[model samples]
Target: MNDADNRPVADHPFPRFSDQELARRRRAVHDLMEEAGVGHLLVYGSDRSGSAVPWLSEWPVTREAALVITPNGDDHLLIQHYNHLPNARRVARGVEVDWAGPSTMSRVAQLLPAAADQGIGVIGPLRARDHQLLSESVGELVYLDAQYTRLRLVKSDEEIERLREAARFSDLSVAAIIDQLEPGMTERELAAIVEGSYLAEGATNHIHYFATTPMASPDTCVPAQFQSTRRIEVGDILFCEISAAYWGYAGQILRTFIIGADPTPLFVELHDVADDAYDAILSVIRPGVHARDLVNASAVIEERGFTTYDDLVHGYGGGYLPPVLGSSSRPNLPVPDLHLEQGMALVVQPNVITPDQRAGVQTGQLVVVTGSGADSLHNIDRGLGRIG
Candidate 1:
């Protein structure tokens, strides 16, 4: 979505999901659970990525959270820490948000029936201890991770608008970096400045401020968060990854900039190849296309004699969901073979690796799938450029 469409900028500490939207999400989950013969369901997650917690409820999990749903359409939350109970009350509206008493499973067991056919379905990664407890309490716990992923893969209209705002915020963050970036500044200093800019613009959370340059050791195509106190040098081809989150939705922009180096043949070729591969995938993206089809279309990198270093493409909003279109050498197995659906958000970057898993240009764009093709979420130049 463009500023011309007049959407709100991504910023805010709390999330935004209207009552109707929330009802729609719950109904979707309920339908899935009922179809799977799940008598009870648990959507487990934490705040690290806000994985399934925010998706399940507007409530952001501080450390741990579980949204429990019964076949009777009753919804509840087993959140941690008694001190955070007030937070639950404020954010987790309508649900029975109760303190899960350090022993989460025990609390979950209390709310659920002790029947062998209860078939408690779980949707996130669980610790062994928690799993054991759940097993004992619920009898048979079913894995529904993929089912949940499928349910969230196609975002709703409201979600698409929020993602658009998030993407716009991230795009603006890149622009902020260009405006503030200068030599003589340490990567850490640059990170702080960039992060602060996004915060001011209303991003409630930050994804990261990572930087890599040709001068740096271990040239991996992957971008690394700036850690060294060493100052950025001249003549170095640098890559930076910036992402910002509004409420819980995330958007990212990855690009490379030349310090003082002349555009080397290697640099230009890698950037151009990655760009072409990006376009190739874009050319085939639309409703009903298989995810692997996009991965297969991105063979230009290998055809041009370059090793890949990162995921050619992955998703966002659900904090990195599946359908990851990977490199040709190690393409991701699109298990279940998910088809491209409208309103799916993804960040595509063909990170070119130079033989030894060491560095190459890592640039990308965030896009939402459309009926005919894909819409670019961020408005930044795709080609590499020199800061000098």
Candidate 2:
């Protein structure tokens, strides 16, 4: 591990983890490539859509990029801008960059094996234009998107520590918001305070879902918008789904807070149900638990006649990675039937909308599926809180 890995703050924008972690990842993927009989492993990425690319390359590209691994375990990092080479070298340790070019795919096509039986495997989506070009002389042309995604589901030893650090930042930022919340503060103002606290607490990135409604809500099924300009009023219920990122790891925290006074009996009851649902999901989650089985655990709330709304659970890294356990409101696309393996990092959020449809409460925290069970990342209360 390097100093960048241990740094609480994102002092260096490049890959903060060590070269060894990068090597380990490459080795794992190389083994997969060999099994698939691929001569090369190509992963596509850009400033916006780069998922596995950033984690693999140790730095996100400002433009188009790709990380290619050869059969001999040699790794190559390609960038669109030649000028990025210097910075890439600074962070993309132990990788060759000279092969990178603004127009890299066509060149990569030149690297394709002439034999029809040999081919390149890709993890991320490749553009149609580039995809067509690369396939011209390729062999098997394996699409290993799911295979690569599953590889990232489990948290490496280094990634788990970073996630814990990120979660702490989110917790501290939320605590600041609650400690200073007062009547007449605009939603935008409160959001700024909360967002700033993220950076103050050493978070590199923050994604928050913010909502405030006066008294109990009329619709409990929907989460609040990301951020808005609306001003808050007295007796409003504030809610947020806070996701904080450090290095490349993320931890999501969901919380609901009532302003000015004590929550009503109905609200408290609803929140308790939501908390129970959260706990219930955590109880049954462990290595080997079916992904869909976790969803069934939400009955603790829905059985009581509360409306379960929004996405209930998902995996987190880089962005909301896969293994999405589906949403309560949307049943058509529940998470797949995959077993939850140990080392996988997931967020379990069970949201309950009061039966009256006037209030909603959501409680969520990050967890890593353990050998015996699951470990909750945050130490905050699991119930609805108050701000006065």
Whole-model lDDT, model 2:
0.73
Error of 2 at 120 (Å): 0.8
Checking candidate 2 for backbone clashes, the offending pairs are 217-358
Number of the top lDDT candidate: 1
Q: Number of clashing residue pairs in every model?
A: 5, 1
- Which parts of model 2 are misplaced by more than 4 Å? 1-15, 81-83, 98-102, 110-117, 137-140, 200-202, 216-220, 318-322, 327-335, 354-358
Cα-based lDDT for every prediction: 0.75, 0.73
TM-score of 1: 0.89
lDDT of 1 by residue, 1-388 (tens): 0011122323423555666787788788889888888888887876554367677667777878887877575677888778887877766654777788868778887777664575888888787898898787768888888788788788888888888788888877677767777888887877776667767767854565465565445355667754567677776777877788886787788888877667777778888987898888889989898877887888898898887766888877676776776777866554337788898888887787677766588788788888888988788888886775
Residue 148 of model 1 has an lDDT of 81
RMSD over all Cα atoms, model 2: 3.6
Please, what is the TM-score per model? 0.89, 0.87
> Cα RMSD (Å) per model?
4.8, 3.6
